[model samples]
Target: MTHDLLVIGGGINGCAIAREAALLGLSVLLVERDDLASHTSSASTKLIHGGLRYLEQYEFRLVREALGERERMLAIAPHLVHPLTFVLPHDHAVRPWWLVRAGLWLYDALGFDSSLPRSRSLRRDDTGYQTPLRQAYRGFVYSDAWVDDARLTVLNAVDAADHGAEILTRTGFELAEQAGDHWRVTLSDGRTLEARAIVVAAGGWTTQAMTAMGVPPRGKLRLVRGSHIVVPELFEGDHAYILQQPDRRIVFAIPYPGGTMLGTTDVAVEDPSDARISPEETQYLCDAANRYFRRQVSPAEVVSDWSGIRALYDDGAGSAAEVTRDYVLELHDKGAPVLGVFGGKITTARALAEDALGRLAPVLGFDAHPVSRARVLPGAMIADIETLARQVAERWPFLDPHDIDRMARAYGSRLIELLDGVDSVRDLGRALPGGMTEREARFLHETEFARAADDVLDRRTKLGLGMSEEERRAFADWWATAFPAG
Candidate 1:
């Protein structure tokens, strides 16, 4: 059987493409070499914003489209995405206050159709905003969003599966040969399949896959490594801070579960698969944070760190930081067609997918149709998170409110289905560290394509951050006994 579309990669862009194609009634098969979101998709700074800084680059159209999608996602995936106010403290010496204000105005104007509040002045003395700052510089507060990046990717795959898309994680795309109307494709596992067309959405692996599939690079790929460091919580409030560096780059400090997530340095690298945070990057983040907050952190205080390669479409930018974040879709429609996805952000993946399918459908012999932007993701069937949390609490009064809230956010309406037969604590089975129950582990493994404990601890949830080494070991031991490796 020939699938209508073969989607390579399981990151945000790849999964979004599969979900969109399947929703259009096209048979789709998506192959990922690792677990879903094991790469760049999960290693994000975790924002759903219009890229206010892009105003400096004059990417108005890109920001406008991203902002529009940001609003749509707030409605469609309310469980995984939540609003957060970002405070951008300005130093008049570097950028004049008027310039900063003008950028904010433009940012708001671009997102005029969005439901989020407009940007406004934040006084330096504002207690909630200044308590952690060293000098209490005047600031501007604007609305944006924070999201569970990993879950966002996985949820897209879940919806794609619900729509009959075959999602094959741990399956790699080896090569493909054009065979008349369809292409015969081979997987890493030595299985051969057929597809009507191909979409190389492999993120950093795009160029490599295209070459194996006998397609040209079509464009240059600049592999910029973006790294993040998790440290002790920097401030008290739920609000995040966008700090401007002397080099004109911006770093964000957002609240994580037990710590704060500070990132991201732009450094060029040759290899995409071996992206790991460097000591210099860690020091850079620490120094960047130290320059703003009264509380200073060293590389020693860093609790966790991760790195992801941005496979950006090189437009001849001199530096990595100067590279554009906009995505470019290259369609090689010679005979049997193949589409290539370049750089894109989580905030723009849905829109990118919509655009890709609106273009690919027609080329693949199907009528081009617009995807339903209002369609909620699978977990968002019950949108009201608080209501769902209350229901879970009422059902499992023995569970802590915090744990219930976590489960509700992670699984949303599916939490109820996850515990369909549960009535008491005894039914929850063994309790792991960070409040992961035996039942939740089973749910992730049986339903969410969790092959290892890290997929549960690090990806499906942020539980690993709060878990002790001993606790992680215990969970791993139990997992090995329960689901022994095949």
Candidate 2:
């Protein structure tokens, strides 16, 4: 099959690029070596905000651009992406109030048309009682957005398919070479595809893809591994906490699903694809969380832990945490030009996709379409989240309220379509061999193209973190029978 563009890597950048390209009337094919978002994209801190700490690195432009994109995504996908308040617990080890205040000022100023609430000071004695904090600490609360990173990636692919783009996950690219006016690419599974232009959005393995295409690197990518750990529920409210440890590196304790999430440690990596969390990294996260919280969560409390590699630009930085998280596009003219993407944040992927489309105008021979910044995502075809929540609640009053809210957040207006004709929680279908239900599993498999049990359990619904090992095995067995490949 010949496509106008063949996007390698169905991670966030590739999915976004393919969706934008397809929406602009170009034929696109997105190929992923494994399941979509099986790597860094899914393992993100899962926030959709401009990096507040980037202000310290003097990354004003990157922070500003990401902030703008944050609001745009929130407006378009209010269900999946929503405003989240963060408490930056202050201490003597960290910067003083004046310095933190200045940072907040810059953060608020850099962001425009903000849909979220602005930052404010909080009295330690007031709401501090609600948090798991020491008596000596006071803090400021600020606004940012949180996202279901994996779902965001999947929704983009689904949207691309809606616009006639062919998205194939677990389809590895074997080789690429110029065949006359086009590039002929071979997939590991024996599928051959032809395309006029190519996009390498392969996140961690971006450099590998360039090498495979026989294209020399125009720029370098710095791989940085970041790790996060999940613990039992810590707080009751919807707010997130960013606590500074004695080591000076800050970690977050955010509300995730029913539990609380503590993360992440940044360590420079020699290889992007091979980076994984070490024993020390896990210890570091637990110790960081223990610094501020009155109730200490030990290493044993960690239900699940994961890591992601940041495909950062090779900026001259001594520390991985200090590396700039900005991105750039490199175009090569072997046959049709191949656009290589390097270093982008989850919050800014949509804007990056738009910019990528602008760059491909001449290559694809299509006029750059007007921006679709305000357009809602496919499942986000609704005005508000409350209505969607109420609609889902009406169907299953017995279902755990928290789970219902999570599904509404993950699936949006499509939650109704996903649970169609179900009367009670039991009618949602047979219970999964695990904590999830068969209806949710089928929704992921039949609708979202989840081919593997881990894709549904880990990324699609996060049941892998919550379920027991025996439960996981049973679920895997059931999934294998339900979704066997032809």
Candidate 3:
């Protein structure tokens, strides 16, 4: 069957664009080389916030657009995206207190209609707040939102499939050429498909995919590597810390489910696949965190480390940190139109998708209708997380409160669907180390496109952090037996 669009890549942008196009009554076929969000999309800092530092670079338009999308995501996916407060302690040696205050004020102004509280100043003796800072005279607390990045991408794909789009994971796009008005495409599995238009949202692999498809390179992309380390809890507050380094870069210490997530060094690399954290990068993150918190962290305390590559549109910036995070779409409409996506952040992915669809509408001979703005994602039927958790606990009183909460946070209103007819713990099947049951694993495989054990333990849910090495091995063995590879 000939489709209206052939979307390559399964990252946030690719999935989002596929959903948008399908909603606009276009047939879309999205093919991913690996599992959805297995690359840069899942390896994000997982915050939905206006890049505060971007204000320094005078990126007002990008910050404002991101702030608008942040509010929309909170409204749509409350369970996965919730408010997070950030405490930025003043460090006069790095950035002055006045400059930081001004930046915070500007950020608040951008999100004036935000449901979250505006930025507030805090004294050193603020109650219920403690930090290990040497000189914590004052600090500013502002609002942002945290997200389960991988789940967000997966839900978009699920929604797209529900709208009649075909999602083909582990299927690579091999080649393409203009055939009449449509593009004849070749897949890695030797299947052929045709589409009137194509979208390349391959994240870090954008340039490579474009070149391989014979589409002339539009511009240069700087592959910037950002790494993070998960260590023991650094502080005792629900709020996270954003530290300003001497080099004018910012590192965040977020309170993750199992521990503190410290990160993100900006280093330029030649290849996108070379996204592993180096020893120097780990030490650098530890030193950045130690500068703020009284309790010092070392590389030895790191439990796990991850890294991702960002394909920033190279605009001749001297430093990787200074490169623009804003995305640019290049359209080649010589025959069968191909839209190429460049640098973008997770917070603004939906907007990027909308813009991408709008640009490709005329070429594909369809009127683009904006539908995602009013529609909820696959599991985001409910708007309030607390209310959903309460209802789940009431229905399944036998289940542990912690388990119910985790399930609700992960699946949202779909938790009810997962627990349908399951009145007892045994009915949910054998319990795993992190409270995950065989029933949920089966659901993930069937509905969320989960194939491997890591797809369940790591991306779909972060239960792997709490499991022992032996537990992980046992779970993998059980999964292999329960659902063997074809």
Model 1 C-alpha lDDT per residue in residues 59-175, reported as the tens digit of each score: 899999999999999999999999999988887767889999999999999998988889999886688898899986887999999999999999899999989999888788887
Q: Sorted on lDDT, highest at the top, how do the candidates line up?
A: 1, 3, 2
Per-candidate clash tally: 0, 0, 1
Residue-level lDDT for 274 in candidate 1: 62
Encode model 3's per-residue lDDT on 22-123: one tens digit a residue: 898899999999999999998999999999999988999999999999999998888889999888877788888899899999999998889989999977
Better of 1 and 2 by lDDT: 1
Q: In candidate 2, what residue range of length 10 has the lowest lDDT sum?
A: 128-137
> What local lDDT score does residue 218 receive in model 1, on the 0 to 100 scale?
78
What lDDT score is found at residue 271 in candidate 1?
93
TM-score of each: 0.98, 0.95, 0.98
Local distance difference test, candidate 1: 0.90
What lDDT does the true structure give each of the candidates?
0.90, 0.84, 0.89
Q: How displaced is residue 35 in candidate 1, in Å?
A: 0.7
Candidate 2: global Cα-lDDT? 0.84
The reply for model 2, stretches above 4 Å from the true place, is: 128-131, 395-403, 421-428
